[model samples]
Target: MNAQAFPPIPFLDLKAQQARLPGLKARLDAVLAHGQYILGPEVHELEAKLAGFCGAAHCVSVSSGTDALQIALMAEGIGRGDAVFLPAFTYTATAEVPLLLGATPVFVDVDPRTFQMDLASLEARIATVKKAGALRPRAIIGVDLFGQPADWAGIATIAAREGLFTLDDCAQSFGAAQGGVRLGKAADATATSFFPSKPLGAYGDGGALFTQSAERAALYRSLRTHGEGTTRYEVLRTGMNGRLDTMQAAVLLAKLEVFEAELARREEIARIYDAALKDVLAVPARMPGSQSAWAVYCVTLPDEATREAAKAALAAASIGHAVYYPRALHQQPAYQPSHDGAALPVAESLGARVLALPIHPDLSDEQAQRVAATLIQALGG
Candidate 1:
């Protein structure tokens, strides 16, 4: 079938998802009816559901994923000269939160195939940081980039050996799994986003933290609510106004009713894309013993020029496409002064070759086929 015969493709069809969710309006209306806008019953309900969904002992909902990261670090007393190791090839938020807290982010190179944090590079960076004596290796923020689980087993071993805290940046990979277990409890603390575009999104900015330790859970709760020990007037420690809104919690509850099915549908779409593009393009590699949330289905083009040409061609065909990250964290102008002039070869080189395609659950087989065929045609197949 000709790609031109298919309907217009959207990079993310939130409207289609909304259409599937019949109870969404009612959920939102309930929030409006109730006067309590902040940390209402819905918020607690959503937290419990989320925790149970991932088998986490507790869930601390927050205003956003960035705040979740900051609160987690704050709970650990990570500040000034503390090194928060993370991948260079991910969204800026992963690195930004560390700098916001006055902690230096040590950029680690990523795997060429998986686009995950390279364990070897992470260990080497930790060693270098210790040798320099300028910074203390406090934590490792292992990111589940592009919805696939990072090598948590390896990260755990390293963190244990080095006496570092493990923070799972599951901002894009909440529904992802490893070794048959879900992501929320993979690290000492896991933070996930509910940005409108994430795999499991809220109507607005929202996030949560997962932990097994009762003390950590209590600390997170207090940190998120202005450090109130027992009463709102009694301040125990410095904190932020990082509470999840009741309305957003309501929206998530409705979405959660169908989340598992939606996740399965995303996998089905990914398989279609894999079968169609793997022969001609560098499709994403499936990591062993894990499942991706399928947040973004990216492909590697030959080079910068080829990527640009393909982007133009996709535009001409009315097919939705995008570039995940045009520059690595170390290369960004804002972080240049902070970067230690480390040569992250794979991360630096990746910006020239990667392109993202439409892979939302809303995509039908015909639309996915059109996307795949259009890309192949764009690449001069």
Candidate 2:
């Protein structure tokens, strides 16, 4: 095939996704007519729907994914002198929340292949921290990296035994599940993002926290709005402004109609990539009893050099690709000081080898095959 005959395949085609926007526009128009943009009726409706979808008793909408994490941590009373266990392979927001609340973020390594938190590494880190007598182990922020759910059952058992709270960072795994249990049900509290590219996304920044405990849910609701117990004017505790916009809720409601269909499409696309690339590259593993939302189809090259060469080849071929986390969180400038010289070999290694291929629910079958073929050729398969 001639290079000129094929145009570049975007990393994420938001314009292709826009074909699903008409229904959302109608919902937005209705929301505008009602003129309750703050926390309108649609917000409550969306919260109820999301709570039911995730098998949680309550869902509290927040302004952004980061806000959801902060509110959940605050509701659990994690503060100064507390330490939150998290995987260093994840996005900065996972650790930033703990730091913002005056708590410490203890970095742990991830599974080299799965790219999820390594449970053994987590235990080791916990033991190291406890032995030091420097901080209290307050919570474990289990991130569902690359849209795959973490080892929640294993993590939950460990948290229960250790007497620590658990929060599922479902920002990238909202629709994911394991052993018939959804992401929200796997942890003490689950926070999910509605960023435009997430499986169940809104038009703009939006997020929600889910929990089974009504008391905890109530506290989160209050904490999201300046910690108001009775009214907005009466403050019971310190809180930040973290309410999700009603317009976003309206858009999300419309998108929810076809969320399952989109998820199915994403799974199909991932399977296609796997079938085409598995022989030549290290494909993502779907652990037994787990279902990923397929937010990204990431593959690992033989080494850093091969990864770089593959990326350049794809670019020259007009095929888009990206490196999700070129640098592990522990190696990042802001987090390096807190790591106390602890090393995360797996995360550091995978940071150099992992590459995210063009993937999205709206990605075309032809485009996916072309991407896989291009990657295979680039990798000299």
**TM-score for every candidate vs. truth?**
0.98, 0.98
Among all candidates shown, the one with the greatest lDDT = 1
Error of 2 at 241 (Å): 0.5
Q: How many backbone clashes does candidate 1 have?
A: 0
Q: Poorest 10 consecutive residues of model 1 by lDDT?
A: 1-10
lDDT by residue for model 2 (1-381), tens: 455789878887777776876787788898889999999999999999998887888899999999999999998889999999999998899999999999999999999888999999999999999999999999999999888999998999999999999999999989888987777878989999999878887778999999989998889888989899888799999988999999999989988888888889999999999999888989999867988998878898878999998888888888878898998998999988888678789988888899999778877899899888877777777
Off by over 4 Å in 2: none
Residue by residue across 1-381, what tens digits does model 1's lDDT show? 454666778999999999999999999999899868999999999999999999999999999999999999999999888999999999998899889889999999999889999999999999999999999999999999889999999999999999999999999998999999999998999999999999999989999999998999999999999999999999999999999999999999999999999889999999999999999989998779999999999888878999998898888888888898999999999898889999999999899999999988889998888888878887777
Measured with C-alpha atoms, the lDDT of residue 83 in candidate 2 is 90
Task: Give the C-alpha lDDT of model 2.
Answer: 0.89
